[model samples]
Target: MPGKDAHNDTPRRVLDANFPDLALPAAVAARLPALVHCRRLASGRSLFVPGHRPTAFYAVAAGEIEARFTGLDGTVSVIEHVGAPRLFGLAAFAAGQPTEYEAVARGASEVLVIGREAYVLLMDEMPGFARALLAEFARRHDGTLRLLQAARHQSAAERFVLALAQLARERGRAAGDGWLEVTATQAELARLAHLSRQTANELLASAEAAGRVRRGRGHWLWRGDRE
Candidate 1:
């Protein structure tokens, strides 16, 4: 109940304007307004959890969603942050399997929920559009796999720095003077980097001393590598 919201008539144009990553073709985009339901979530509430069968995949219209995996040993791995306009839960839908991760709202958020039936209908009616969506899914899956591999191979400090850099690339705003501002708290960063909070803080302090970044109250100003 904490995360639930009543559906509203959100326009397709609004969805496109808010989430550019969706990038549905014109025809498919035009039809989505009628086929989807909208939901709003409060911070830290779950959208779905492991073993639950979801009939819909979600696109974050606003805010962030964290997909986390918990092992039997109780170690929780933050798999990804699904920021605005990004899609999640597609692999489960494709495989017709129960969800394997817990999807939780990172803060106040809005999501566009496309049901399996509507998704299947669209795919059947628009092969090209389906191909585009599939391609996007493949690309993201590859990226996630790479990140997981990096976590396995990298040291904690290395993982923290690399995770911060990647977060900056994806979500940070240009703060001028070669710095990017990312709105992530220490706990969140630690989770993302797969480190304990104290370990993450120590690494951040060292980085700050080296002039690599300036940690702010609730955000970070990082001097990222030039790309």
Candidate 2:
């Protein structure tokens, strides 16, 4: 009965010292310790696999998680990265179904797991917390919509420019020499631009050549207005 396997005996994760204080109702926050436990994870650990029955929603209290998708052809897809205080398994917990993606630990991590039933009950009792969670989901949805549009509608150059512009606005620091503090990796920047890694590298080089931007050791600087 692999399909009916149960995870009732799974270990729990609690709030870690490094974890940020989540915006939950006072009552919900008080009861959260009862529902969630703390866990110490090893690097590259698999939290859950796709298609497995999901029993709880996980929050990374002290580290990071990677959301991954596995195709029928065995291709592994890196869907997204989630940092501390972010929630995973919400879809499975919300839909009462298996998780759509696998979650893995990127490094040694402390995580909290709230059982599905407990989460639902807490949400029903704390409408404010539920609203906050819903708002976060909506924000992610909007970002996904924009990513889809960029992938399908925009040229690679347009996507590159747009992504740089958005990052500059969101994470840019003081304008001395116009340096940006964004620390996105090449892979991450490629994902943001909705382009392949090679294409992204080429475009970045092109931007530098045209004096549109300067890639630094740990930051970027807007160098030109070229397109």
**Which candidate leads the pack in TM-score?**
1
* Model 1 CA deviation exceeding 4 Å by range: 1-30, 120-128
The lDDT, on a scale of 0 to 1, for candidate 1 is 0.78
What TM-score does candidate 1 get on C-alpha atoms?
0.79
lDDT, candidates in the order shown = 0.78, 0.65
Residue pair clashes in candidate 1: none
Question: Per-residue alpha-carbon lDDT of model 2 for 92-170, expressed as tens digits?
Answer: 7777788778888878876777786567756687556566677767766575466557767989988777666555543
What does the lDDT come to for candidate 2?
A: 0.65
Q: List ranges where model 2 is wrong by over 4 Å.
A: 1-25, 148-154, 158-180, 191-196, 207-214, 218-227
Q: Write the per-residue lDDT of candidate 1 for residues 84-159, one digit (tens) a residue.
A: 7667888987787899899999889888888976677667765465677778788778867867887899888778
Model 2: which residue pairs collide?
13-37, 13-38, 14-37, 14-38
* Candidate 1 residue-wise lDDT at 178: 83
